[model samples]
Target: MTRHAELVVPGGRYVLRRARIPGCFLHAPSAFGPADADGSFLVDLLIDNGLVADISAAGASMPADGPAIDLAGRQVWSTLLDVHTHLDKGQVIPRAVPDGTLEGGARATIADRQFWTEEDIAARMRFGLQCAYVHGVSMIRTHLDSHEHLAPRSFQVFRAMRDEWAGRIDLQAVGLAPLAVFRTDWGNRLADLVLQSGGVLGGVTDALGVYEGAGDAEMDRLLDAFLMAAAERGLDVDLHVDQTEALDPFALPRIAAAVLRTKFKGRVLCGHCVSLALQPDDVARETIARSVDAGLDFVTLPTPMIYLQDRKPGRTPRWRGVTLAQELLDAGLKVAIGGDNCRDAWFPFGDHDMVDTLHQSVRIFHLDQPFSRALAMAGPMASDIAGAGRHGRIAVGAPADMILLSARTLNEAMCRPQADRIVLRRGKRVMDPLPDYAELDALAGMPA
Candidate 1:
């Protein structure tokens, strides 16, 4: 209770100890076996069946000399939740990032990365899944492109991952089709394919931006058809909506209106409402208010948006492709940040950890200027914003999924994150750190 210790729990080592608790009612650590507020309580931890269930005081008290784990005062918060991601089709163009594009600099991304075999996807999923575990991302909603009628093959790979990792990670797969692909009736088969393949029903709106001709209206109709099919099948929806300078704020409002009318509000997640960033503050506020009022959850991809933005000189360039993250928070919207791409054509590099994504976001949004706030944001605050649920906290009933850090305080742990930060999927031991975050950093650009 007052020292550094690690006990073998599900998935990995269970490290527990004392620390200054964050000043939030929801985040206070609880005592085991009912004690005075002043006395410290045991914090049981484990990752099993894929969920983090920390049952320190369930029906028993700590034995006088039984097994114990001191987390070295490191915080044991709930596992992280990354509500938005595209693990299957990263970079939309993976091989071209480091080498730049054929046009001298980096080539612009049109569709997601292609030419990946099922083996390639499986390998990528392995890396992404493992990295996600270490970074405390216990849950992920990933979109996989089904553009070339690849859902049959791709879904097979994702299913294997889901079956293999089961409780280790809550993985949701979405079938993605570009608006152009949809209008040409290419996605028609893909939608039905995703339905049969048993994945989430999802699509992209910005793909509509690239539409050239009479294809535009037809694409809209296809999107509607896809949404309807998803609804008929009782599937949730996520869309890559309004992702360019050409996107109008009204476009998202229109979608929100449709969702409201269809009563599919909470089931719909609208990603990268980039148009919100271009609008006036009031207008942006009102637009999101309507969407949230209509029950649309939001997913912001800060890193990729920053990576893709035209940082060109002057001209009052108007596209950032990021939703109003902090502003949406201020509006009490259910919003979470996700790593949109890793080493893909869109973003040449991403370490695959939610912490990395969170770190970048803090810097981009000026959330880390104070330093101290940045550390806390990496854990508690990040969890809250990203729907870590009862996760991202060290409380009763929260998932036992946790990371054991090397530092005692929040600051030290973040400044030097470690693989020693044991990752627990539930109550089962999954991995022990022969190598940690240090090695992970050193071996950058490798698989995951």
Candidate 2:
């Protein structure tokens, strides 16, 4: 047996032997066994042609032509997936000091946008991606600023990065435009840009509440237009809805209603929905039911939401800015938690590590009593929302994108985070250098 710390490359073939993994973490749900005796199993995985060719008992025969790696009973899991992030506006901390309010963060972001050249955005985005990749995230879906003036350039830069980073990390983009823009010719233009780049159509429904005198009629029109455009172009829809803590009319139900009315053919995803936590139980249950009826998916960004919602200067926060994750899960709605912003104007503190996000969410949502639920949020649940089929699970014929951690159990993995983790992308060990933002700054002709 080869006792290598990292799997070797060039050959693109290896047999991971004696790797202990949770039964629930297996790709096939039916394979999950009881948590007592069959909770953790030692298995041998055969990798061939960038896929898991076979898996068997620990002492099974190894691939004749490939080296066998001994995991020594450490835990291994499928690489994480980030369903929602703001890559176009990441890594601008300190440069854009937020005033600890959502509106203030918007102002800071707009002010900083004036200095965003293609080089600057690309460098920052590349750095964020590198951090996420190193931390075992194999797939990410980033929401880009789609203002009329900023989107074209940002999209151009993102497209170049997408092509450049292909095969290493799967990058998906969404054009996050204001809700009102969808009612004008600009909406058509935004749709065209999104179709051109093969990105999802995204709008911020929470901003609709800020529109003076904008009632349900106006909101419905804007959402209908947005969904119609996406349906026409065969694109999916992802919206930032009801991010505020106010009990104002929840847009989640409205969004679901609009999807039903528009007869949309693509998948619909709603992020935030923080207001759901504040709603009365009856109202929240009704809204969740409507959302499930419409086939809508949900992603909760706990970090940024907690940082932005109910935040009044000089006052302690009363509520955690997270969605009703447990309620959604119990209602059988697909819910995933994501690391939304990383060192950006919105939140200003993250390393794009989903494990860290998982840790925080497990506490905030009280998901530790049954650790499997929390684990799914960072792994399988997020992957389901990402729609990047077959990448976030471990099974025969599945893509071998996974992380090897230095923990013996789920509780140990969460309580004691490790830095010496190994990442594999498609059966090959990834050894890319972490991004140096200072060098990127120099390359962009900015001050260190």
Candidate 3:
């Protein structure tokens, strides 16, 4: 009693019966539907990772016992993707620090962040990596925080992890430092070290507000130096451009012009452009358009953006706290969704689950209009923006990374996210259920 059997055809018609279970039978499509006379159907129609297949009647010759999952009515979608993230510096819940009125919050964030050690950071990075892989994330761009003296330790460990996981996951590591840190000569030297050590260039800048010894001019100068250094080394840019309501949207244009002037078009990325949320529609739209014109991709950190919104009323229209996602999409600019900080000094709470981030994105932007497009945002679209296309799609030539979701339908999967199995590198299943392609192929050959 096994489900192993092959389908045989007489060029006309045949019946397929359950291998072990005798009651059920495979029925051919009626004279009016889409199934062919031979009962073979397309496994994929658009060559876009759409999993489709044909069915036939179960015949007596089929295996007597076999597992069966009736796919008479089901929907399957391609895996999801998370383009921008900061896993290396994440997983440390920082405590607030003394910074005037917000001193408490700052001190708490820093203290909490300090609790994570090199081993803990590595473990957290691996966990985050696994979580993303399970959720169908084949590639990610994570900025590693290396500002304080502790950076050397974290970067060394994460660098080793990155090397170990290189073939399995496409990981891009960026170097991060606050604006004040970059003002010092040592900061400039460290920035070079990051680039030389296979790190993407750039980090967070305090262009709008200043910490105790930081100034606005220093922030701008730091950004200039960072961009200039990246250009000199032929590296790409990813900056924490704006993260609060205090900054003006004009700052993005300033960066955009500098990018154009430096000729780093299509190489710069700005995450958490939250200031655009506060700017007038016209101004925001124009700034975004110029960013596109200057080749700056935007990655919206929906989770943290929502968390940082002013709780006080009349602060600003229930600030979604996120930048204009739909607007960027409509303007034909590159837009991605990222898990900005997961238990890090900023925000300090996340699970590396990009689907959760997408759920937030879906809700904030009223993305119910066309769900597929929204899902695409969490996947290939973002991958394309971050220059990580090789691992995004599931096409034959593309990387064999994929995740099996628990849901049976596209909408169900998107609405109710679940991770059943995760495969990385080349069809190597890291999580449970494992690779069943042999079983699937054997079943596909069953006689009907």
Highest TM-score, which number? 2
Residue pairs in clash, model 2: none
Give the TM-score of each candidate. 0.75, 0.92, 0.73
**Superposing every Cα of model 3 onto the true structure, what RMSD results?**
11.7
How many clashes would you count in candidate 1?
A: 32
lDDT, model 1, position 403: 57
Give candidate 2 regions above 4 Å deviation.
1-12, 29-40, 60-66, 208-210, 443-448
Which ranges of candidate 3 are over 4 A from the true structure?
Answer: 1-78, 92-105, 113-116, 207-220, 247-250, 312-317, 406-409, 419-425, 432-448
In the range 217-263, model 1's lDDT, one tens digit per residue, is 45456556656667767677778887765544245776676676566
Candidate 2 TM-score versus the reference: 0.92
Best by lDDT: 2
lDDT of candidates 1 onward, in order: 0.58, 0.81, 0.57
Each model's backbone clash number: 32, 0, 45
Clashes of 3: 45
Question: In model 2, how large is the Cα lDDT of residue 409?
Answer: 73
User: Candidate 3, residues 1-448: lDDT per residue as tens digits?
Assistant: 2211111211111112221110101123231134332222222211112221222233312233432322232232344556667676554432222221223344554564554566656766776776666555667777776666766776787678878777656777777766556557756676677766777766765442333334545445656776777777777877777666765424677778677766763378788887787887888877987877797787888876676655453455466778888888888887877877665545656676776777777778777565545666766677777776544454434533444334434455556655442233343334433222222122211232
